[model samples]
Structure formats: C-alpha cells, structure tokens
Target chain A: MSDLPKILHVEDDPDIREIALMALEVVGGLDVVQCASGAEALERAPGIAPDLLLLDVMMPGMSGDETLTALRKVPQFSETPAIFMTAKAQHSEVDRLKELGALDVITKPFDPMTLADQIISIWQER
Target chain B: MSQGSESYLVSLLGPATAGAVVSLAILLMIGLLARSALGHRRQLRKIREQEDDLALQRKAVDMHAMVKITGVDGRILYANDNLIQTIGYSVEELRGRYASDVFLDEDPRIAAEMWETLRRGDAWTGDNKLRRRHGTAIWVKTTAIPKMGRNGTLDKVITVYTDITDAKLRQQEGPLRAMFDRLQDEVYIFSVDDLRLHYLNKRARASLGWERLNYRSHFLSETTSTFDEARFRERVAPLLAGEVEAVIYESSLSGRPVEINLQLDESVVGEPRFVAVVRDISQRKQVEQARAAFVATVTHELRAPMTSIKGAMKLVASGATGPIPDKPAQMIDLALRNVDRLLLLINDLLDLEKLDNAQTEIRRDPVNLAELIDDAIAHNMGYAQEYGVTFTALPAMPSTLQIVGDRDRLMQVLTNLMSNAAKFSEVGGVVEVGLEDRGDEARITVTDHGIGIPEEAQSRLFERFVQAETAEHKKRKGTGLGLSIVKSIVERHGGRVDFFSIPGEGTTFVIDLPKASDEMSRAA
Candidate 1:
C-alpha cells in the first residue's frame, strides 16, 4: 500500500458516487477514481492500476460480481483486493460476498465520516 | 173340468166324501207352511255366524294396531289396548284427553294443521314425536283417516301410530356420523354442564392420543394443554350464553398449532353442548411468515435510494464539500433526522424477517454484560442528548457477567433498550442500567424515570407495530419494533425479557441470560 492508496470506486447511483468521492478525496485526502458503472470501471481500472476496488453489487450492464470476475482475468489485477458495497447486509449474503473474492462487504447508507476510514482500514489490513 | 156335472152327482152320492176332501186340503197347506218355517230358521243361523266372523276380524286389527279414534272436536273417543300399552298409558287415562295432547311435535302448528286436514275429510300421514307417560318422546309414523257419518258430516278421526324411533335414529346417524368421521378436521362434543368429553370422532381420538375406554369420562382439559378449565370457560362463555353463534381461536396442541372452531349445539335431544372442529394450521402460519419476510426484503431493497440520499446530505452537512449557509444546514439536519427514522424502520423490518425465517446467524462468544452495557450507553450518547436525558451505569455492576452469545446481536438488544429508555425519559431524567449475578444466569435491568407505559398498552407492547398512543409517544417517531427485536434476540440466546411499568411513575425492563459454563467458554 502507498502513503495515499489509489482506489477505484464503481457505483451505479450517481449521488452515492458523489458522496464517496467527497469522503475519500476531500475528507480523507486519498487518491480516488470514480466510475458510473462496472463497464466503465473495467475499461479504466487496469490503466489506472488502483490498489483497491470498491464495487457496488447491483448494477445495470455488468454486476459487481461479473466485473470482479472480469478484472480477475486481467493478469495485473488478478490478486487486487476488492470490497463490495451492497444494500443486503444479511450474514449469509456477506459471507457469500466474501466467498466471491471480496475482502469485505460494506452495507449501504454507510456513515460518511467513517466511510473513508473503514476503506483505509481494509486497505491497510490487506 | 167336471165341476158342475160331477158336483150334482157327488152331492147325491156322498156327504161323508165331501167332508174328507176338505180335511185333506187343510193337511196339505199345513205341510207347505212347516217347510217354509224350517228354511227361515236355517237362513237366520247362517246370518248370525257371519256377524261373529266380522267381529273377530275387527278385534284382531284393534289388538295389533295402535288405534285411536278422536271425535269431530279433536277429543279422544276411543283408544285401543295397543295404543295404551305403547304410549305407557292406560286407556282410561287417554280416553278423554285431546289427541293433540298425546302426540307432540317440535312445532306445535304441525299437530294443529294435521287436525285441520282431517276435518276437511282428508287423511293425514307423517312422522311425529309422541310423548309417553314418562315424558320421553318416541318417534312414530302416524296415519289419521276421517270417518264420515251416514248423514255425510265429519264424524271421527281414526289414527294409527307405528313405532319408528329406532329406525329414525339409524336413518339420522348412519350417513351423518359417517360424514362427520370422514372429515379431516378433528371433531369433539363436550357436555355443557361438566365440559366432559362426550364424543370424539376418529380424527379427534387419533390426534388427541385418546382411546375410547380411557377418554370416555375425561374432561376437555385432559386432551389439550392449551385449554385448562378457566381458559376453556372464558373462551366458551359466549358460545354457552348464546351471545355468539360460533367462536374461533388459535391454540397449540402438543406443540402443533391448530385453529379451533366451536359452535353451540343446543338442538341436541337433551342438553346444550359444544361442538368443536379443530384444524392444524402450522403450514398456513409458515406461509404467512414467509410472505412477511418477502415483503420485508422488498422494503429493505427499496431503502437503498434513501440510504444514498441520507449519505449525501450527511456529507454535505459535515462541511466536507464546502461551508454551508445556516438555513440550508438546518434543513439538511432535519432531513438527516427523518432519514434516520426511515432507516430505523427499514432495519426493524429486516430484523423481523430474519427472526421469522430463522435466518439470523448466532455466533456464540463469551460476552461481558458490564462492558456491553457501557458500550451501549456510549453508543446511544447522541440519542440521549437529543432526548435531553442521561444514562448511568450503576457502579455496583458485576465486573464479569459472562454469557455465551453473539456479541453484536446482544449489543443490538442493549442499544435498543437504552435508546427506548432515553426516548421515553423526561427532560433531564436519568436512565439507570444495573446488573445482577444470579447463580445460573445474569440479569440486566434498565430503569427509566419517565412517563411509563399506559396500563392498557402494556400487554401488547412487544407486538409488531404496536405503539402506545400516549402524548409522549405521539411526538416521537418509532417503528415499534425495538422491543420485539430485543425479545427475539434475547430469546435466541437462551434468555428471557420482561418489564414492569407503572402508569405515571417509571418502568423497568429486565433481561436474564444464562451464564456460560467453563467448558462452554473454553470450547468457544
């Protein structure tokens, strides 16, 4: 991990993306790149060479799970740690997300002040 | 032909011969009259023998048949020995009695209508219940024929009663009882006075684990633990008093859920009784629970947008983007608070779904009660401040009240209790949390000095979406799922939750969790 970890954040909801951008870039002073959808993230992720992938589980063209599988096919991104953000926070769902190569599953409507710190913690642990 | 010449010759010849001829004529007439008299005597003897034979035939019919003759005015004119014996009455006792008085019907107008029909010179035949001397009713088929007099006026009504009680009962019981026994639902009949089990269909006997000989005299309570004497009386009071036609309730029998439908059967021959039909409803309940979970899942999914909206507002309100004006900041704050309320509703709905579906995972770990309470208080500090209340953990709290349970779920329970305590407390009121170490369990009590729950609402406080309609609660927004969730979580950890509340003084909620054994702690 670098002093300022480069992160790729993929979300379908523009408002949630804006909030996460502010929380990571403005509030927590981390280098963050935002994509409107998983397809856009797949196009930009490898070139950006981000240290972490923050993906929304529900999407329009490519779901977070599909995007993760696609990113794993890329040689450089095969072992990159990915975290899932989902509205469903059931214990079983979280465990399932972890089994799908996600380092952790963060429930939505996350506290804005703690969101960046939570991501950093995950990154540092990874 | 020789009358004139012969007469002249005879007149000269013999006076003695003429006298002899007159005597012969007289003797021949006497012989003819004697033969006619003997023939009349023989015909008279034959007529007398025919009259004796007709009387004997009538006597044989009267002996076998239950014959009664009533006059034109409906008064009994004659009653035969068969009728008197079958009616358990003497002929003298029934002779002067009105025919209607002996034959009774559930409907009095039936007898009246029959008599009217007979008066119209028509025969009446139908089944009737005839009362005996002992006041018991015997069913009979009756035929009454009106006998017209020689002057062509209504004369007498001759009625014959045939015993049909046994046959009638068989006709009623054969197909009817068979149909009742073939039903999938369990059927029961309980005596009205003692509430003793009078009859149970085959399904009822098998479902209730009863045998014919052993359950004959058993009371209803013996078969079901759900209905003791008092509860049975309470539930059946309306049915017995005829206040309601039927009553329905749900109860568990042998740990299986059943719906019981009880109806008053006052039309039974003797005493009024209760007829209950019980059907197992466990599958129905499971389906209902599943549907509720589905609705909750959809609702939770719907909250995703609200979550994003609240998150955006929160970020903007924190001055992360830029400094905001005071009015917009206040607006954002208000929106944020409402968002929190919506989130609470969504969370409560999800928790209920999880609880009902048994999808909540319990990962047992050693949890310390005192530390959990302290963390809960700290977590709810902001809420306490908003409610203008303070939370205090008693200094005498046990240091190590350990239990085996999921820490996060237990923390959720404690947080709910503290949040409720803060919400219900008066301004500047102090909420106290205390712990007691019993031998086998640890008890935690949360006491709040505030307007307590109303007496009427206390019983249903833990039911889903049931909020007390008090003035204090009216101003506060609650999903009413906090306490129910607390109860579910505590119970899943092998604990019990209860509360004591005074209407105007204060309330105390107690939760008891079983202590973890050394071996269990080591195993965990």
Candidate 2:
C-alpha cells in the first residue's frame, strides 16, 4: 500500500457520492474510487486495491454490511478497514455496525470540509 | 153423604172390617215418612264430603307455593305463610295492605296494567321485582288469576309467586354484565364446547345489525364474518386448553379493521366460555398510516436538500474554493449558524415523533455516569464557548458511579440540558454538572447560572413545542421539543426527571436513575 490512502466510496445517491469524491480528492488530496452501488463497488474493489472502504448503510442492492461481508471473503481484502456512512445515527445502530466489523460510523449531513479529516482519522487509527 | 152411608153399612156388617181399614192407612203414612228422612240424611253427608275435599286442595297449594288473595281494590285480604316468610314480613304487616303498594313495581303504569288484566278476568303471568320489609328486593315469577262472583264481576285475585331471586342475581353478577352493557366495544360470549354464542351485549347486537328477537338464537359463526370456522377454532384452541391467557388478532369486520381480544372464562358456572371484545380500529389505523407517510416524506424530501445545503455551506465557510471577503464571510457564518439550527430542529422533530409513538426502544446497558457526563461536556464545549459560558463539573460527582440505561439516550438528555444552559446564560455565567450517590439511585444535577424559567411556564416546560415567551427565548430559536424528549428518554429508562427554577435567578435540572447491581453489570 502507498503512503497516501486510496479509498473506495460506495453510495447509492449520485449527489452525495460526487461531493464526497471532491472532498476526499481535491480538498484532502487523496485518491478515491467512487461506486454508485455496493455491487459496483465489489466489482471494482479488487482492481482498485483501495486501502479503505467507505460504504453507505442504506442502499438499493447489497447493503453496507453485506458488501463488507462479501469483501472479507476475498483473501486480499480480508482485513481491510471499513467505515459505514448512514443517516441512522442512533447509538444502537452505530454500535451494531461496529459489531459487524466497521471501524466507525459517520452520520449523514456531515460537514463536507471536515469529512476528509474524519476519514483520515479513522484510516490512521487502523 | 157416601161416608155416612158406608159407616152405617159397616156398623151393620161387622166392627172387624172397620178396624182392618184403619190399620192399613196408618202403615202407609209411616213408610212414606221414613223414606223422606233417609233421603235428607244422605244429602247432608254428601255436602260435608265435598267441603272437606275443597279444604284439602287449598291447604296443599298454601303449603307448597307463595299464595296471596287480594280483593277487587288490590287489598291484601290474605297471604300464605310462604309468602310472608319469603318477603321477610309478618302476616299482620302484610294483611289489608294494598297489593300494588306492597309487591308491585313503583311504576304506576305497571300496576295499572296488572289491575286492567285482572278486571278483564284474564290471568296475568310475568316476572316482578317485589320490595321486602327490610328494603331489599326479590324477583318472583308470578301468576295471578281473578275469581268471579255470583254476579260475574271480578271478586278477588289469587296470585302464586315462585322465588327467582337467585337466577336473577346470577345473571346480573356474571362477568361484569352491567359494565359490558355500557362499553363501546362489542362484546360476545360463546360456549366452549359447541362454540355457540351464549350472550351478546347491547353494543354487540347493535353493531352486528342483530334483531333483539333472534339474536339470542344465532351462533357465533353466523354472526361474525371476520373469522371462518377453521381460523376461529385455531385461534380459540389455545384459550380453551388454558395454554394462553388471551388471543388477540387484527381482522376486518363489515369492511372495517377491528382488533379482537378473546379469552376463556373458565370461572363461568357450568362450562368454560370464550369472551371476546371487538374494537373498530379503522380510524386509528388511518391516523398511523398518515403519520408514517409524513415522516417518510420529511426524512427523504427534506433531508436530501438539507444534506446538499449544509455540504455547500461547509465548503464555502471552510474557504476551500477561494478566500472570501469580510462581509461575505460574516454572512456565510450567519447562514451556517441558521443552517445548524434548522438541522437541530429536524433532529428534535424526528426524536419527538419516535418517542411519542413509542417506537424508540431503550437498550439498557451498564453505563458509567461520570464518563458519560465528561463526554457530554466535551461534546457541548463548543456551544458553551460560543455563548461565552463555562461548564464546571462539581467535585460532588462520584468517581465511578454506574447505572443501567441506554447511554446514548442519557447522553442526549445531558446534551439538551447543557445546550439550554449555554443559550440562556449570561456572558460570564457558569453551568455546573454534578452527581450524587443515594444508596440505590444516582442523582445527576445540571445547574446553570442564567435567567430562570418563568413561574407560569414552568408547569408546561416539558410539553412538546412549548417555550417560555420571553425576549431571550425569542432571540434563541429552538424546536421546543428538547425537554420533552429528555423527559421521555429518562422515563423510558425507569428514571425520573425534574427541575427547580426561580425567575431571573437560575434553573437546576435533576435526574435520578437506578444504580446497577453487579449481576446487572455482568449481564449487560
């Protein structure tokens, strides 16, 4: 893995995905590969060899947890750090996502400028 | 002249012939007298025997039944022993009293009807509630027949009463019948053995469109359209077998949603019976659907735009694109602040909705109160700084106080109180958070040195969307649901939340939570 983190962002909403990409790439100066759905992320994840996974909890097909489970099956991505992005900010939901192997859970409508910092903190912790 | 001539001839013929004629005449007279006396004696004996038979029949009726004889004007001429004993009255007390005043209902119409039937010489057979001497009433099944005089006018009424008080009382006292009759929900009772309907309240009859005359004869299967035979049997089998206390299911009856609660009444007299209460829930269901749809639309349509606006504002405020001028920067700052307020309002609205609907489930776990307070202070430190207020953790707080509750919800309560304190505080005011150990409970108090709640608004402080109408509150925009949400969350965790305040001085909020035991901590 390179010094600069390579993140794979999977979100169903095009607007959120585009803004997040700009935040991670332009504002934070990091490499990001964005996918519209979990299925798309799974297909491109092996080729991208991203250092981390940023998955949305509520998605059309293959939820964040389901995608994480599928990715963990692959030997190369077994121990990759993953974080969940969701609108469900309840403490119970956050704890449940953590139990499912997410490094952290970030709530929606997050500060765009600070989003990259939040992700970087999680990456560094990993 | 012929007799004189016959006497002269007889004297001439012989004295013996005259003596024989006299003897024959006397013998004939004695035989006739004897026959008349024998006939008169036989007639007297027959009359006495008939009177004895009538007396015996009257004695038998008086002994076995409650008999009473009333005159034409309803005067109680006589009352049998059974009648006097059952009514708890002496014969002297009942005699000569008007039967209507003694035994009939207090209603004038019923007494009038009884008299009319008797005057018409027709028998009156019905149930009557008669008041006793001691003021208690007894029900009797009565039959009164009018006796006609020689002139064919009604002379007297002979009434026979059989006590039916026990059956009447049982019917009244069984399973709260009076209360069931007054209920709005339809109630029905069915025999467990045959699944036949045994009783239905007035509401049930009216709701099911049943006629009073035929309702009692109808079976449960014919009355309710919601449950077929197989489904009803399946649902009722558990109750009949004492496997479950009650069976509740939602189904439609008469094209409307209804909730049916059925339970077995094993305490009923002969056999176990099933009692079911059916409530129409269409209106409640409609309201729930409308609320759910509104929440979904608000979450989706509103949050999507909010996400974009907040994101764009954050980028502008961060100076990511380019450096902003002074005036523009100030406007951006103000706009961002309002945006944050709007976000808080949205979050508070959702939380209040969830709490009101009881959809928010409290997850109880062992939580360290001291750590939770520290985290709350850290999280709200920015707001305190913005408002030029300081938060001080009083030394009274215990080092390792623990309780069983949902940590997130408790933290939310602390955060709400802290934020409110910061908003209302003077520039140099201090907000203090303290904890006290009280044996089995942990008391958390938040004290803020700021303008306190007005006395008039204090009572309604925890009501949704109610804010004290004051200048400071007007300037500070809020959803007015924070306190209500805090109260709900605290109460759901089996805790109490209360506050004390003095106008223009300060306010202090206290929350008491049960302390966690070692077993509870381990289980959590």
Candidate 3:
C-alpha cells in the first residue's frame, strides 16, 4: 500500500523479538511493527492493517494457528499475504499451514540480515 | 596198750588154745568185713547228696531263663513258661507255628527276613513286634543262639527274650512324630531308590487334593493330574540324584498358572525327600506385562513430537530455500533451542524408563577411569569457558586406573555432572575434579563454587522434571531432568552418588564405585 511494504511480526521470546526487529528493520530495511505474543498480534493487526503478517508458530498463551484464526475473522485480512515463522517446518505441517490461508512458512533461526528481502520476494510471488 | 593186750591174749590162748584161736580168727575176719562195708555205704550216701544238689540247680535254670526252641524250618518246636506267658500262647498253641505268623501286616517282610537269618545258622538278636494269641501285639527283644552238633551243623535255635512292648509303644507316639505331622507346610518323605512316597503331611494332601495316607506311594504325576508326567519326572530326577538342591517351575492349576518352588531336605541324607511350595503369581505377571506395554506406548508417543521438531529445524538450518535473514534466523534459533530442550526432556524420560524396565543393557568392558574423566571434562570445558567458569582436574591421578564398566555410559554420567556444575556456577568461579583410591573402590568427586542448590531443592534435584528454587534460576533454561538422568545412569552401573551443598556458597557431588581388580579388569 505504501512505498515500504507493511509487515507484521509476532513473537513471544524477548531475545528473539529484539534480534528479529533489528534484522528486519536495520539490516533488511523493511517497514515492520512487532507484537510480543500471538494475543497482541490479534489485538493490533486489525488496527495497523499491514500488507503482510509474519508470525512465530510457538507461543505459550495463543499459538500461531489460533492467532491466524482470529486474524481471518477481520474482513480486511481475508486476502492479505501471510507467512508463518515456526520451529516446526515438517512437510505435513507446512502443507497444513498453507491450507489455513498462509501463503508460505519461514522456519525459525532465520538469517536476520535477509528477513525483509525474503518477505518481499514472497509477497511478489503471491 | 598194744604190749599189755598181746601178753593177756598169749595167757588166754594157752588155756584153751584150739577153741580160742578159732573164735579169734572168725571175729577178726567179721570185723574186717564190717569196716569195709561201712566205707562203701558212706561213699554211696555222699554220691546221693551230690545228685540232689545237681537236680535242684537244673530246676532253677529251667524256670528262671526264657527259652524257645525252633526247628530248622523256623517252626516253634518247644517254648518255656516265660515265652508262652509273654506271647499269650499255651505251649500246645505255640508249637508248630511259623515264626512269621505273629509279625504285623505292615512289617511282614521283616518276619520273613528274620526267619531266613535263623535258617542260615546265624542267630538274630533284635527287638520285633509280634502278634499275641489274643490278637494284641507285643514288642520283645530276643536273642536267638543256634544249637550246634559236634559236626558244627545247626540243630535248633535257643532264643532268650525280654518283653519291651510298653517301652516301644511309648516311643511310637513320641514328640518327634508329633512334631513331624504338626508342621504347617506341605512335607513329604520320598525314597531315592523307588521314588516311593514314604510320608505325606495334611497340607501336602490338601494341596494335592488327596484323601489317602498312602498318597506318598503315588507318583507326583498321579497326585497332580495336570502335571506333565515326563517333564515332572525329568525335573525331579535331578533332585533325587542329589545333583540339584531345589527346583522352581510354573504350572497351571484350575486354568491359572501357579509357581511351584521345590527344595530338597538336606538333613535326611542317603534318603531323598523334597518340599514344594505353590504360590499363585498370575496377578503379578499381569501387572508386569501391563507396565511394559505402557512404557512402549509412552516412548513411541513422546518420540513423535521430538522427531518432528528436530527434523524441521535441521532442514531450516540447511537453507533449502533462499538464505534466512538475521532477524528471522534468530527467531528460528530460539525455536530450535526450545525444541532441543524439549528433546532433552523426552530423552531423559525415556532413559529413566529404559533403566526402570531393565531394558538399558550395558556392554561392560574394562574402561580406563582416567580416560573417561578426561573425555567428560574436555566435552564440558568449552561450555564451562563460555560461562566464564574455570575447570580444573587434580594432578597425579592414576592414568591407567581401569574399571569394569560401560565406557560410553560412564562418560555420559561424568559429563552430565560437570555440565551441571558449570551451568549453576557464577561467572569466573572454579570447579574442581578429583579421585580417591579406596581398596576396592574409586571415589570421584566434582566440586563447584556456584550458587549452590538450596536444601529444599537438593532433595528433589534427582527427581525427574524437578527444578530448583525459582529465584535467580528462572533465567536458566533446561528441562530439569539432568540430575535425574545422571542418578539413573550411575545406579545402572552398580554405583551410587551423594552430594553436599550450601545455598549461595558451593556444592560437591561424589560418585562411589567398587574398584575392579587388575585380574578382573583384564578378563573383562
């Protein structure tokens, strides 16, 4: 929508949160807003209206699947390009996430420097 | 008197010489004959007195001594008053009776054997029970001596006997027999030669469901109908031959398999006897089987999730797609670490279950204790440096102190302890490792100057999934099963662990293992 592609990042771990923010914002140079938990992303994603949402698969309170289900309830997010960031990227799990309306999956321990570039390329392909 | 008498005889003879001389000669002859007759009569009277004394002595012996005369065929030929009275038989009734007729039915062979002994010219002397004429049995100790002719041929047997019926009957019901029949356990006496059952207790009869006392004569298969005859005979053969002391077997009774534990009685030497105890263990076997199934289910279920998480992480790290960016890669790293922690937790649980199930078999061999310690220390040193802690091993330790052990498992145990030390220690703290040589054991101790576990936590530290106090420890990440795994692995190796800790000060963990001698080490 804007000159910078809007990206939504959800995470529960503080260290991973800080590292993810730096890699996507400073290194990859992408417009990004961070949510510390799946619950926070559900609450704020509707308001921020991002073009893409990048979600961590595991969180204690609300898992990525649950957050995604909540996001799909919003009318504007129905066709928004979304990707899952998870530790579990098995073939079956990846296929299951795609069926749940996710465009793609990015495994955790991701390279921080190229995270935003990956998001753009996925968005272009979509 | 002789000179005066001679002078007077001479004067009288001159007066009437012829008539006086004839009278004197006749008188002298009569006197001589009278004296000789008196001496013969005195000898005859003395011989008569000696005859009376000999008859009295013969009468006394005949009446006082017990006498029995048996023919060469062991038939009673003659008996004295004492023998007839003791056996409750008249002489007319005792005569021509076979010696075996009076013996008890249970011991008929004894009577036949005793008769054979007498017929062989050897006298039999022993106590035996004989049935009286009134059908009441009396025990008598008899000594029979054979009467022999000048040619050394046996003519008859002269037996002298004493009645011991009352004494022998008293001993028959003595405390020994009472004690034997009163035992609570099933007991039996079996003969080695014929395997004849000689004795059986009330419990043994009840266990076998037998009502007859002569069940002892019945074979084991006959008593236990369900028992496999050949198998039972084979199993008991060893016990009978004195090769095996006891035998244990599981057999079915009323469709339920029962455990039978048979033990030989060692005190009754030369005669074989066995005592068997039957116990029902069907419930225990069922419980064990169920436990094994549960362990298998848990292992399969737990391993599934762990495999998924670990495999996916490995794929992501290898970059099948475009390379991952720094921030996303860091998030992935966080997930990977948590997955690793979960995997460790599962591994620890599975390890404990394996140990509990006795499925964790160790291939034991002679392992150099020094090398084991060195490898463990080397593996942990990098982590120790990362935590800014110093690790030190005491010098002059035996480099070749070998022990019979599973090398890999022992290394794992030592590494776990050292890693725990480094993880719990403050930065720049020191950890010490040392070994002491005991006569039959080696004691390895690991000391760390760390924020030692609190007393309350120390007790639970070796329990599965148990963490220490929440304060100052919440930052550390772990599955909280390291110490438990260490304890289990150590115990499996026939070793034990002990530790002492002071909160906020330091902690020390000691491993005590029996030292393997050089000979044993070489053999292993």
The chain B TM-scores of all candidates, as shown, are 0.44, 0.50, 0.49
User: Model 2 - which docking category?
Assistant: acceptable
Compute the TM-score of each model's chain A versus the native chain A and list the values. 0.95, 0.95, 0.93
Stretches of candidate 2 above 4 Å error? A61-63, A66-79, B1-172, B181-297, B398-401, B438-441, B514-524
Chain A agreement with the truth for model 3, given as TM-score: 0.93
lDDT value, residue B215 of candidate 1: 72
| Each model's iRMS | 2.4, 2.0, 11.1
Candidate 3, residues B104-218, lDDT tens digits: the string is 2225576567667766778778775556665456666778787776777777888776666546634753565467567654565554445566556666677667756567447
lDDT for predicted candidate 3 compared with the true structure: 0.72
RMSD of each: 17.2, 11.7, 22.7
What candidate 3 gets wrong by more than 4 Å, as runs, is A1-126, B1-297
lDDT, candidates in the order shown = 0.83, 0.83, 0.72
Model 1: how far is A101 from its true place, Å? 4.6
Ranking by DockQ: 2, 1, 3
lDDT of 1 by residue, B1-524 (tens): 24685576469758677656756766888999999999999999999999999889878877766888888887888888887876787777777788667645546688779878887889999987777665556677889999988887779998887778657755766676688889999988877778787678888888876744567578887786666777778888877677778899888888988899999875534345689899998898898777766754574467667867887888889998789999999999999988888888888877777766543577778888899989989988997899999999988888977999888888889888888888888899999999999999999999998888999899998898898997777877489899999999998897999999997788999999999989778877
Error of 2 at A15 (Å): 2.7
Q: What's model 2's lDDT at B283?
A: 82
Model 3 TM-score on a 0 to 1 scale? 0.42
lDDT for each residue of candidate 3 in A35-68, tens digit (9 for 90 to 100): 9888788788878889888887767789887888
Ranking by TM-score: 2, 1, 3
